[model samples]
Target: MEQIALKAEKRDISKKGTINELRRKGKLPGVLYGKNIESSPVAVDAKELLKVLKTHGESALINLELEGEKHPVLMKEIQRDTLKDAIVHVDFYRVSMTDRIEFNLPLVLKGDAEGVRMGGILQHQKRELSVKALPADMPEHLEVDISGLKIGDTLTVGDLKMDEKITVLDDPEEVVISILAPKLAEDTEVPTGEQAAEPEVVAKGKEKQEEE
Candidate 1:
């Protein structure tokens, strides 16, 4: 729950051309807003923001230093350039340390599934779980061990162990992971329409012979 330090400058221009100009100068445009707080347009060094994202990820608390005033915030949304794979814009949500906030935590699978060794497929239905916790009590990730899993066994959200301070927001009955039975040859080798019709054609020919 350590907060990462970042600095941002207030932005006056919001036009598309101006935003592109800022990006060419290695700046990223963003906005900061929260309960009881007025929204403010801001910009920060793109390289610095990338470094913070790489180190702290999106769920961690950020100490956003804006014009000498420090705001504890969380990254709410990030828009990326799909082709260039660069951050285009971001949204920050200010938060109080003691307030409960909801966020998604990654699910980590530990240990190999016993069913996998038996030719079964290991499937993960939920890769992350939504949780509510205080800023200081948030966990980086949740883990589930699958070493004891057998074919047809399913692990649900209710099966996970969590910290007392953290409340899982996901449905308790929702599946998180499971070991599925191995696929049979027939299951994988479905016959084409023509191939399937051949058997029906042969059956009809036998009926015609009996009639004759």
Candidate 2:
């Protein structure tokens, strides 16, 4: 994974009121901690942080600045305002250049499957795979090639290979993606008109029986 050099400074003041004030001033409230480091409250811009997320995605390495020092970090988690799409809280984990960090790497499918070319549909069961690796050795994502897959062919975890430094957390037998024949897809939705007409037909049949 490509690690970009980004820095955020510590915030001297912190409180609910201060956070609200900070957001009003176009800043985001967050904290940086983990490993052998003390927790530091920090504030950054909402727009800039979002840009970093969009550019680097989940495989981002954040470099936090405190008192002229740079802390190599990763975004561990984030809390957001669901309605407004605003970031409410952020968690940053400090990582060592030598130690391995566990992260859920996204799975990217490359090359159209031969099955799909033959009118088959590709189904993906997992979007991300958990793995542990050194920060410098972390993969941005695992790419699975599906070029030769035919209809009913499934790509499972066992078919995946990774660098020696990376350890996949999921079971090797788990299915990741599969090519399904279009005819095999079953429609499970009920027909609204059929459902609405069934009761009237039953009522009419009962009325006819009573009259007879």
Candidate 3:
């Protein structure tokens, strides 16, 4: 539901050379399309988009301003360079405020549980969830409090709260987060025979030195 303004410009020429040149100038090549809108190659400030991704973590909605028109969009796919790991291209879906849309919202745990404090390992199996809801009703994050969690306690999709307009795509009883038993270290160290004998020789050398 949080919105950030991004400035974009329509592209007349779409080619690999042009895109690479744009990247050299720190611009990101992207396409925006949805519903009845025509897909157009557009360019936006790369640094600004990176800042938004950092602040919103892919879950935050974007308000893209192309020329003077504002479009509410969701980041559909981001393509990064394999060697450089830099964002090369991005795909955005223009969304309507009134229509219901599905998104994979991230799950965040709040509070340190007693079980985790008691030598239990906290395991998060799933990071995001699929939910259908209106764009205005979409939550930035799905918070699940682990304060009451025990060693074997688990939180499932059904345990989470959703808006009346939201529908969850995952199984109701699917375990999302759980605490497991902490791994214990082995009791004894098993030394190799040759390495163990080398220690005795060093001890003998020390004994001989002491005798001198």
Q: At residue 98, give the lDDT of candidate 3.
A: 86
Which digits, one per residue and each the tens of the lDDT, describe model 1 over residues 83-156?
Answer: 99888999999998878999988888999999999999999899998999998887767778999999999999
Model 3 lDDT, residue 123, Cα: 88
Query: For candidate 1, what is the TM-score?
Result: 0.81
Residue pairs with backbone atoms closer than 3 Å in model 1 (clashes):
none
For all predictions, the C-alpha RMSD in Å is 4.7, 4.5, 5.5
Clashes of each: 0, 0, 0
Instruction: Candidate 2: give the clashing pairs.
Output: none
Per-candidate TM-scores read 0.81, 0.83, 0.83
How many Å off is the CA of 51 in candidate 2? 1.3
Indicate which candidate wins on lDDT.
1
**Regions of candidate 2 where Cα sits further than 4 Å from its true position:** 13-16, 184-212
TM-score of model number 3: 0.83
- Model 1, residue 184: distance off in Å is 2.2
As a whole number from 0 to 100, the lDDT of residue 177 in candidate 1 is 90
lDDT of 2 by residue, 93-118 (tens): 88998988789888888998999999
